[model samples]
Target chain A: EPEVTQTPSHQVTQMGQEVILRCVPISNHLYFYWYRQILGQKVEFLVSFYNNEISEKSEIFDDQFSVERPDGSNFTLKIRSTKLEDSAMYFCASSEALGGYEQYFGPGTRLTVT
Target chain B: DQQVKQNSPSLSVQEGRISILNCDYTNSMFDYFLWYKKYPAEGPTFLISISSIKDKNEDGRFTVFLNKSAKHLSLHIVPSQPGDSAVYFCAAKLGGYGNKLVFGAGTILRVKS
Candidate 1:
């Protein structure tokens, strides 16, 4: 089965530095999303992208966070400036169709800030 | 306002027993519900899903029952095996396009032999 692929399984970044988390969703998927989970916390939705534009975003997805489909198959989430609170596992998900309930997720990128 | 809530932190069951995980929701606008399973250090894997219009959906040993009136849902795993142990999460999609998924805290299931 094809699955979403994320790069840099684990990242160690400095505070106030920029970090880009990359994901290559399933080749035929049309919708993509980014979600984060703090340690021992529930998964929180951050943003969703489609057709090269943001479809929906949460309050957690503020000015510092940006998502771009830099290419046809790759989706990227960029954090303008890392903060201590930015430390978490960021997951990327994709679906074959819109308005569908099932979304396959990637292994996730664990961002650790020191 | 957290929409989806899973009150149980963990559940342990004997092998070949029934394991039930429950969830509650505060939002009525959610039309779709999904359950996911996660092993340590891995992303969540989709388990089963139920729509607001249906009260039950089943697959293999897993069965999801949705109670629209009570704003509750439950996932039942019968004849549970050791491999069935994992953290289970119940997620909801607000409406119109699965844009975002609001997730619950999750329940850790341990099936012991």
Candidate 2:
């Protein structure tokens, strides 16, 4: 079974530095998404991407955050400046279609900002 | 946003027994519900899902029951095994082309052998 895969399973960066979390979604899926879970918190949606554009984003996905599908398979989330609170497990997910389709998730990248 | 709620923080069940995980959602517009299983150091794996148009959906030993009237759903794993132990998250999504999923805090299930 094909699965979503992410790079840099664990990332550590300075508080003011930048970080890019990369994901290669399932090849045939059309919609991609990013979600995060702060320790002990529920997984929260960050943004959704389709057709090389952002479909929707949450308040947490402010100016500091941006997503790009620079290539056919690569979907990346970049944080312009990391804050201590930004440390969390960032996950990437994709679905073949919207509405009733189930989104498949990647193993996640654990981003740690000190 | 508290749209989806999984009241139980954890559950323990003996091997070969049935494990029932419950979830609730306050949003009536949410037309789709899904359950995901997660192991340590891994992302959530899609387990099963049900649409609002149906009351139940099953695959193998896993069964999902939805009560639209009460806005509640449950995942039942029969004949549970130790490997089934993991954190289960209940997620809800509105019916649309690009709607995002709202996840609950997740319930930790331990299926002891």
Candidate 3:
């Protein structure tokens, strides 16, 4: 079965640095999303992307955060400036239909900010 | 405020026994609910779900029961196996938000053999 794939399984960066997490969703999926999980906390939605634009974003998705589908298969989340609070596991997900099907998740990328 | 909640932090069940996991939510607008399973170092895997219009949904050994009036839901795994040991998360989908889902703190289930 096809699945969403994320790169850089683990990353550690200093405070005030930049980091970009990449994901390749299932080839036929049309909607993509980014979520984060702080240690021992519930998973939180960050942003949703469809048709190359952000459909909706949570308050946690602020100025420092941006998502881009630079090509057909790659979805990326870039953090312009990282902070200690930014340390978390970033997950990427995709769905074949718009709110009609279950979204498949990829193995998350653990981002650690010192 | 937490829209979805799984008050239990962990549960243990013996092999071949039935395991019941419960969840509650404060949001009324949420029309869809789902359950996910996850192991260490991996993202959550879809388990089963139920729409608010229905009271129960079953798939193989997994079943999800939703009580709209009580704002509560439960996931039942029959004849649990060791492989079923993992953290399970309950999530609520806000229909108006269009695919945006709010999740609860996961319940770690240990199915001992």
Please report the candidate that would top lDDT against the real structure: 2
What's the best-to-worst order under lDDT?
2, 3, 1
For model 1, the stretches where C-alpha displacement exceeds 4 angstroms are none
What are the per-residue Cα lDDT tens digits for candidate 2 across B1-113?
A: 89999999999999999999999999999988999999999999999999999999999999999999999999999989999999999999876667689999999999988
Displacement of residue B104 (Cα, Å) in model 2 is 0.6
Answer with 1 or 3, whichever has the higher lDDT. 3
Error of 3 at A92 (Å): 0.4
Report how far off residue A42 is in candidate 1 (Å).
Answer: 0.9
- Report the lDDT tens digits of candidate 3 across residue range A1-114: 999999999999999999999999999999899999999888999998888899889999999999999999999999999999999999999987755658789999999999
**For candidate 3, what is the TM-score?**
0.98
Question: Which residue pairs in model 3 clash with each other?
Answer: none
Name the candidate that leads on DockQ.
2
In candidate 1, which residue pairs clash? none
Chain A only: TM-score per candidate: 0.97, 0.97, 0.97
Q: How accurately is candidate 2 docked according to DockQ?
A: 0.85
